[model samples]
Target: MVDANVMKKTFTVPEIKPLDQYDFNRAKVCASVRWLLAKSYGSAENVPADLREPVLIGQELQAGVSVLLLSPDLYWRAHSQLHLRGVSQGPGQGPGGVSKGPGQGPGGVSQGVVQGGDHVALLQLLASRGHAPRDQDRPVTVEDLQHTPIKTRAHLALIDALMSLAAMETVGRVKMAAEAEQIGGGSPWENALLFWVNRLNQRLRESTEDDDDKTQTCTDLQPAQPAIRYRKDKVQSKLTPTFPLVSGVKDLSNGCAIAAVLHYYCPSRLPLEDVCLKDTMSVADSLYNLQLIRTFCCGTLQGCCPLAVEDLLYAPPTLHMPLGC
Candidate 1:
């Protein structure tokens, strides 16, 4: 960073703000993108030395990011320090220290295996950056780059890490960073309810009409929901609507809504198999689902602001904005 010099015709360009869309012309064609990364991470010194270099928009960023992801620590650190914004302390040196130096993959193994904690951190960071792998069930092992068992996990994670970086580069910052207030008097719950209802109506084969504040299965409805059009023997079959009707705010007490919404937004974080469309029968059931939602939001969905089970269950007016957004 240097002072603007009228003598040299060089002008001061502000650092690309987080969540704000990057100005391609100034960011790439003119200004060094290294300044943006440095500023984002706090200072040039705070930025990890490994990734401290000028980068253009395309191949340069991709190549640099891929090389960084091979070790896990650098790429995770870059996003954590540069993007997570107090969400996490980046990837920690888990059970084993991360791999360092070139040609240090499988051969230099002793301290390179990514442990369970690191694996979770990587996934959370990646998923939060909207770069989670499509294949969610598969686990990242202690031997990601350390050992090659049929397939290399490094390449798989590389794609995620690279795309995650790209997303961080392009994602738009939230509107009105200076001051945030609910636009209308208060309509977050109603707006969220309408948005979900309308969106699900379009995508889902059919949705339960959640007209009342009652916990009831699809069968319990006064009139059965519509069946899907597809058929096995030219005869239409009734598709059981996994997502039940959400009448009022309390209807989301079960972790079902969180799973469904987050799954829809970021499917890699919460797979379709994990979403339970059923309503909670008891407090234990609600808590179990709520815990899952909390982990998903706080860990997997790293970008989203953390919300507690009480906040979610109680359906407070304060949460209307978060829910709607």
Candidate 2:
């Protein structure tokens, strides 16, 4: 059972500051993206010595790989309200529904609506910045992405890694949801729920495989088979269940990271997949606490500042110290 104390704690929005205040934060993110791109597509001299050989060799073998980047506008609009201050209810919760409280069930992995959208925006902005010398001034488009080939093997490897991450997240969410329901019903070990959840996941995987098979068959029969058309609205409505909007920031981060990494390495392939959720409460909590520390430090010193990247990547030391020390 979820602790009542945990459920009672409110999740406040991070304070809004002027865009200039976040310059360091934004620059750090952009720099990481630039580094990843350089490693993936740059010439041997441009790439770090350690990565030069692999990147150059990979370029020759991974020529025709493609990725599709889907627009996140629908997702952004879906969870726009979650960013507002003092809004306690989680995204998509109806009246009197179970609110996703701090430390309640798998809240640690819950997606932050604002952060996810921010990542999407960052990717789009970076993609607009062109890759090659001749194409650097030209604007990137969906058409450009569809036809472009991935230049580096590392970039393709990263995409595969992200797919694995996304699959893990999908499985985690399904298991978490099932566990929450089981706990809510006063039986933590319900065999039926466990079996049902497993069955559902298996079906989803089978459906994806079936779709791939059908697509391959359709490609072979394209010349003789007439195109089937449906109203846009009807198609979208049918797809709504399969493509949920409440995706976690980690997944969004993965997409943005992939896009930024591939923009220069493989402009032709945009990463695309069905949208899914991620639990990000733990990361959010860490950020919130870090900001609080920064606030205190700034108050003590006139302008206490540190590299945002260090703060982001820092991990708390796990030490076994004596109490007296």
Which numbered prediction scores highest in TM-score against the true structure?
A: 1
lDDT of 2: 0.28
Model 2: residue 104 alpha-carbon error in angstroms: 54
As a TM-score, model 2 comes out at: 0.17
lDDT of 1 by residue, 1-325 (tens): 0111211232222222332443322222112224334433434455566565444453234345345344545434333333333243223321123333443332122243222335555566556655554424554443554342322334344333443343333222423221212222323334334335434523542333342223344675464433432223232323343564554445566666656666667766765444334332344445555656766755754324223455455444434323332
TM-score of each: 0.31, 0.17
Q: Model 2, range 168-262, lDDT digits (tens) per residue?
A: 33334444445434323222222223333335434444554565445455355543321222233222112211211212122212122212222
Per lDDT, the best of the predicted structures is 1
Q: Candidate 2 regions off by >4 Å?
A: 1-20, 24-29, 41-284, 288-325
RMSD of each: 21.9, 26.4
